[model samples]
Target: MSAPLRVLGIESSCDETGIALVECAPAGEPQGVPRLLAHALHSQIEMHQAYGGVVPELASRDHIRRVVPLLRETLAASGLGLEAIDVVAYTRGPGLAGALLVGAGMGCALGLALDRPVLGVHHLEGHLLSPFLSADPPEFPFVALLVSGGHTQLMRVDGVGRYELLGETIDDAAGEAFDKTAKMLGLGYPGGPALSRLAEQGDPAAHALPRPLMKTDNLDFSFAGLKTAVWTRMQRLEAEHGQPIAADGMARPRADLAASTQAAIVDVLLNKSLSALRRTGLKRLVVAGGVGANRRLREQLDEACRRRGVRVHYPELHLCTDNGAMIALAGAMRLQSGQAVAERHYAFDVRPRWDLSAL
Candidate 1:
């Protein structure tokens, strides 16, 4: 077998601390499918859930505690060592400052120790490139819908490091809407997943949630209105019931609410994505970020794209959520594209708000 260029990736943008080892060779060469040698993730969801949201200091502390051990485990699982690693990649910006520092510090330290090349990967770029990790990687010059808790944006992705922001949310992101609406419904913290699960049985028709900016010519979105609509509907429901909707009632009405909310979100996302595609004149669409994990969102995008003869690509379910694999894969692609290089100074700082357009 030909020697494969192995890469170690570290991701710690928020509550997730991940480490992965991936190998690369010529795309169609006979070495093997670009393979995942090993991967590990440490989620701070449970810890942060208690606080209803991620506390940056807490997230940073967790990363320091988990990164080293996870790295050890990833290497061992992949049956490789520091010597086998060809490059080190880490997420550099657009995340909690503290958390990004932890990952960046760890990654740079590793690279320096191994005397290997290292690259600073944009968090969104990692998400955009995530689909390439799959066996059926999409060609470049595609449209991208990036939906996460902290961001909602559409982009024209021509290649690695070549991205143009088509549009973005002017207000609350779709994930934020889900979280806020879920809280209004007493869904507790980290409401996006919980709400999605509940939405499975909701009769979307039961509530006529507003599709914000549905008719706007701009690709920009605003979920604040939709979230307000949800709040208003819940208040009306409570007034009608004369008591707070019981947790038990949540089960009976959960599916309908979930379906409706999910539908509204799906509609907005779908409409905006298609609009971006039309404007870019690109038929292929890629959905990334945490919200991309939503089943309904994926199904709707796939179905709609199919009808229009456009294509839609998504990262694997595991990669859809925050993980180190994407960071690693993005780094590998950048290196292969000669777009980035290792740093001589190990004093890289985290950007809590890095713009993709800046790349």
Candidate 2:
């Protein structure tokens, strides 16, 4: 076997700054799953909580503060010095521009310093390929459900850098739905998980909420209507109680609403994923991204795919969120597939709106 190519990856796409090391076989050999040597992530959740959402400026500044330390942490964990890296990679686009620049600039500067090539990775592509880092890595040509904070998409993944968009959200993505619904419930910043925790206590069928576009023939999703329905129901409950319905102290009402909202979102995601699989005639389904970590969604998907005799795969729960490991792995895989080559020209720019299909 040829010696492994080591990659240092950096991610600062949103509220998280992540650093990781990955290694893969060079070209002209079997391209197995890239090995994740070590990774570290720093979340800006506590910092962003006061605002109820991420402040781009704050997130950008925090990324600047966190990236170098995280990189050092990852290198130490990997027992490798900076000189050991063969290439440097970073998330390049489809995120806050300032935040994207931090990683991009760091990666390019590192490449120049190390005299190694540099790669710019697509953020969603990293998410889409993350399941490969799992103990049970998926094979090629699977149906991928790329559901995240800003994107809800089903893509046909033929191989590395080969993605075909099947369907996508016309309005708010599933993560947005969860977060917005959670905010409506008075759950503070980082609402998705808090709302999910509350969802466990209540009955899902209690509110009879609408699942928008659930019956549609196409795989396209529309979640804004579901958000509106939740708001209307909460308004009705408030009027009936003669007070504003709040997230705390009203377990039954809030929990039931949280459960129903979660159910609705999970249902839509589950059905669309199944439809994508059915239409494509693929037997494997790989779910990745932040919402892929939703317990309810995972349970339903497991049950449904099990009955259909279809295989299902997910990134190890912790890797479901944004991280540098996936970016590093993606760079290695692209090099293996001869789909991409690292460049030495270090002049760097960030794309705040690049599309995966464009790759």
Judged by TM-score, which candidate is best? 2
| Candidate lDDT values, in order | 0.85, 0.92
Give residue 279's error in model 1 in angstroms: 2.2
Identify the runs in model 1 with alpha carbons over 4 angstroms from their true place. Answer: 1-3, 25-34
Query: Which segments of model 2 are wrong by more than 4 Å?
Result: 247-249
Clashing pairs in 1: 199-258, 201-255, 201-256, 202-255, 202-256, 203-256
Residues 1-359 of candidate 1 have per-residue lDDT tens digits of 45677888999999999999888873334433356778999999899988888899999999999999999999899887789988888999889889999999998888888887778889888888888877677888899999978689999988878888888999999999888878877778788999898888677788889999978999998999998887777777777666674467556565666678878988999999988888888989988888999988888888888999998888898898889998888877776676776655676778888888889
Which candidate tops lDDT? 2
Tens-digit lDDT track of model 2 for 182-280: 999898889999999999999999898888888989888899999999999999887776666683546688889999999999999999999999999
> Ten-residue segment with the worst summed lDDT in candidate 1?
26-35
How many clashes in each structure? 6, 0
Score candidate 1 by lDDT.
0.85
Give the clashing pairs for model 2.
Answer: none
